[model samples]
Target: MFEPSRIKNFVFVQKIIKSELMYLQKISLANFKSYEYESYVFSERVNCVVGENGIGKTNLLDAIYFLALTKSSISNQDALSINHEAEYMMIEGSFEIGESGENITPITNNQSLITISIQRGQKKAVLRDKKAYERISEHIGKFPVVMLSPNDTDVIRDGSEERRKFFDGVMAQLDSEYLENLLQYNRLLLQRNSLLKQFSERNYVDDLLLDIYSDPLVEVAVKIHQAREQFVTQFLPLFKKHYATLSDAREEVEMIYESEVGAENFTQIFRKNRPRDLAAQRTTMGIHKDDFAFEINGFTLRKFGSQGQQKSFVIALKLAQFEMLSQQKGFPPILLLDDIFDKLDDRRIQQLITMMVDGTFSQVFITDARPERTRQLLDNLGVEVKYFEIVK
Candidate 1:
């Protein structure tokens, strides 16, 4: 027999005890990027990596990103992530994941050790808890991360491919089925394009083989497109909400999902586009051809938006990404901010700091070239922050 007040208190305490806690606890880098060898133990909440320009601040953050995503965030070539004089690069991170209570000691079995290494002329290897994963894709969403960097401008400045990648990346972390379907679609598209090239070079067309390749492509393309549509439907509101918060409702931002196969039968679209694809010797339609058109006040953001507006737009997009991943994964993703303060205004920085203090974010890694500026900005926050300075 328990009093109602006591029962309420017990439930509240239990809720706090059961809250999920996930964060990177430590990282070690060997021959990775600019680091020959380095190890770091991180605070569970906020970590600030400070250094002079070219002193490897971004490299350290990239190491953490590599550990989470099993790849480099900035470089397309894995070899480029290795130190100039080194033949191999390795990054490892220890993550603590489980419940934490105020007084009770949490169980120790929640720690996950993830390791990634790449040797010259060899494929990258990824392992978790001393067990190698059969496929690296299996590790993607397990340790979710959201990165806001200077390069994020590409989402606004670049062409449709970049926008597709932005959305696809978010969907990949949230829905594994979307990733599998996307991968299959890409592989099928590659084969179909290769077949198209062969047909073009030989000046011949095989309807049977083309149809055989197109059938599976259309099937997978439908799934991928449907997933993208559903994702956008859910993602748009989040984006808008963050944009309004960041911009104070001064401007209207919109994103329209543009797909060539919209509302049309996929098989017919494939058949109709086969002749053109044969002429082009590449894929001309399908999920790969999808793009998100970003606009402000019904005009193109890329062409009409001011630089400040562009920056805010991308920030909102990332915050929305952070929100969506947090909701779907049941915990906030680790945030990596690389030289982002230099690109954003003071207001936006304050907004981010407020979120940090409010616990909207769990673990965050920030890199800055100016040590004093970084310290000055964060020193007054009164939150637990660990600062690591890089020295050449």
Candidate 2:
């Protein structure tokens, strides 16, 4: 889908700054996905994971993602990560913080250990440096990561919920306050919906209790709406810049945030929608109902953009996400590319290799089914790439 004559070339004069980068030095997996038990040591600059299709390259990357985020990048179910024959899963990663590239391999200085284990019908346990975190979400922003894969195309092709989830995940990682507010909003919404159902089933309504829920829900909904608006404003320039470069400056693209919260009678609308809400047995209007309209030259990209254009758009979104997180966190986040080379042409792949040398990312893990192709691309680039070949 990423058809292009030539990927736009970026002029980057910046040099690599290693002291602020956080990178994974080692990782171990047990009963996780396709891995029964495995341990890997990674290079500080670039790690190339090469394996035949279905040989678990992506699962390996997911292990790293799970260690960083305490959940699967591919799904919401922790049970799915367990091997078919196993009842539990465990992943542990050793990371180095604020270390220079010149530091010795497996440098013990400033190292941190993060481990997560999940068992049948039991909550996942997470420990950082052997001390448990009270909540899993608290570990999210501590070591941020950005991942790009073929599945990212869903953010454009799917309905509104997919788009909201992608943006919300980005916001949650960059802003802790935003994450806290979003968690609270979702909790309140669930309870309020249950009360609505209870009111209808029993033919009883407590106006005071309803009012209590409605007031707080409305307040947080407005805050989320506003935060989303601000996020889009800040995110626009970066997204547009990356999109323009990826597309070679062809076609104009825009993202319009659609929300009912912008209405002057937002609070009144809640009061007005109560009867309908009771009939529907759900909270139907709020920031949860918001959507993002992706447009190419004022037309919906989903409806009009070509296959090549859509792929470029999604990749650009991830690139912008990388830039934003790096800027906000003061160090680049670990980048995981899941066999992306197979999707791009030699010329387009050159753009990514160039960015690697320009310090666009601190540490990157790339999976390629064809090791020769990866070698051909990096052979003369003077880049340090450590290759890992998996055998079935």
Best candidate, lDDT-wise?
A: 2
Pairs in clash, predicted candidate 1: none
RMSD of 2: 3.2
lDDT for each of the candidates? 0.84, 0.84
* Model 2 lDDT at residue 106: 27
Summed backbone clashes in each candidate are: 0, 0
- Over 89-175, each residue of candidate 2 has an lDDT whose tens digit, in order, gives 999999887644533132335788999999989999999999999887898878889998878889999999999999999998898
Clashing residue pairs in candidate 2 are none
Question: Can you give the TM-score per candidate against the true fold?
Answer: 0.93, 0.93
Question: What lDDT is reached at residue 71 by model 1?
Answer: 75
lDDT of 1 by residue, 329-383 (tens): 7667889999988998888888788766555677889999887898888888767
